[model samples]
Target: MPENVNYYHITPLVNDLERFFNKYRLLAVESKELGIKLETKDLATFKPFPNKIYVMGSLKLSRNRKAKGILIRKEGKPVLNYSVASLWEFERSPDRIERSKVIVDYTISPKEAIPKEYGNLFTDDFMLWEGFSGMGKGGGRPAVFEGKPLVLPSLIRITPDELEKEFLCRNLGGIWTPKHKASAENRITRLQTFGNTFFPMMSRQYFPISWGSWESFRLEGEKYPALEDAVEPNV
Candidate 1:
């Protein structure tokens, strides 16, 4: 269970989001691992596949858009729009998003920080010496926001240099890298951004686990109160 999860709320110019996601690389990888079959020709045939998060349909708001992520329950609490990479900040990162609920102290709500001037698009500045996203330093030493204060989570990677730059740039670097595109194969390219050093660990960590493993129904009813039991098995 990831302790911290980050969301990159991208409201792109792409028109057919469903088509884009169906053929999207990362989604495909996720589908393949989950035994999900998606076809661009069949939209209704899809479902996130009965999967907990099948695309959820893109979010929309006239003045602003919404995209929630990695929704999980921590200690029976709910965590929405969290970062998977940020989980490293959790003292006990079991990679179980379901086990851990959102910690108010940990979230710095980005809605207010939306860089609308940058085109009505922007995320809150969760970049701290140790926030949910990666760190930043700007210079070789990583500035305050860029500086890394702890280990990185599996789905997210931050290099020594990445931790130094300011949030003004870099957080969404992967998307521009062509790897994070809607095309799908971009998933590899997206993960490839981790480079050789971190990608190895991240690759292994991001592997698809059985669905019920990462998902929990505590909020949905099948209750299990022991949220953070180290003795419990990991997905």
Candidate 2:
């Protein structure tokens, strides 16, 4: 019998957003195989989870940076769900140092990558991630807007002094201190989520199988789900 080795690369794209999400799904399955459970419920109603996980972010390589894949935390342990190299390769155990580096790089300057509509809302260093609920201690503010609740699936950057004011003025879904800023930000930077003040958010969606299930897995592997193969691939 021959070894089952697979090659991976980012896929070409006609639709950018569609491809990015496809990569996200692949990463989710890889996370599952690593024993990291998918959090399906709203993250707002419970005590804060100890890990600040980022489901998607840009990866910096020697040549250039590519916007794709990220690390997710489960039960207080960091798991390298997917990376640029994950499109074709599967690792039983990713290196701890690489995992730490991915988490750190995930929080770097994401200003340019932010959506145009969300521009005026944030002007400081920020990190974007899904599954954010502004409840619990140090979990930011309650996600309320115009007497209604909002679903926060993204993370933003702010300052400690501006925390209270931002929540009130920007109608932020919630505002709170980042428990691990000293390490994640390496400075006094606060994190926030989208609210309905400037660009209102839609209610959260409930998925029966969650966003990324092994039900979508393939045996031969996939191309990087990027619009371009220039950076890296993880489809």
Candidate 3:
């Protein structure tokens, strides 16, 4: 197995906020079972998880190069209020080199999540295809390919600084993170699941299952349970 495969993350389709939160809760529970803790926080207040996974919630970006705030929940609904200096802090931090992070954004409702103004900076069809193809063992397909190249809002191991300077600034046209590439290749080559039970169940899901190498096989069977069996019951 290749190195640097130490985290697995699933960024839900954000067309429906309620569904997004529901999926987040389920992912958190599954991560916990694998001895990994995932947290949702504003970029400014973000802290390293130290061998764990951190899922970023909605990030409000402005044209002024400063983050307006983050999306949070109140009264069982989504709200945006948490403030941040800049998304670049992810790279400035000393611990970032050793830490693994995945940006959990969604492609659903692109207008609402990623506006046209920032399209050049965030949209990348080739990278999205590469990542998904690698994750699903060559069976995954891009979700937002509307007659054009697909766009993946979620990214792994890429800091805002690199994103702006290397990818966006240079007009690179796609993600250039080496760790993400390595992780994708590693997963495609090493990660394997058996039995038609989990395979068919996973195939029926609407969302893609993009995970990192940090995840353990012990949780594989439980990770992608059938929808009917996976949904949590109302209290």
TM-score result, candidate 3? 0.22
Task: Give a tens-digit lDDT track for model 3, residues 143-232.
Answer: 334354433333233234533343322223322322333222222111111121111001001122222111222233332211122122
CA lDDT of each prediction against the hidden true structure? 0.22, 0.22, 0.24
Candidate 1: deviation at residue 68, Å?
23
Q: For residues 159-226, what per-residue lDDT tens digits would candidate 1 score against the true structure?
A: 43542331122355432122223231112223223222321112212111101112221232211112
RMSD of every prediction: 18.5, 19.9, 20.0
Model 2, span 16-55: residue lDDT tens:
2211212121121122222322221201111111242223
How many residue pairs clash (N, CA or C atoms closer than 3 angstroms) in each of the candidate models, in the order given?
41, 9, 7
Question: What is candidate 3's CA lDDT for residue 77?
Answer: 16
Off by more than 4 A, model 2 = 1-56, 59-67, 71-153, 159-161, 166-209, 213-235
Query: What CA RMSD would candidate 3 show?
Result: 20.0
Instruction: Provide the lowest-lDDT 10-residue window in model 3.
Output: 196-205
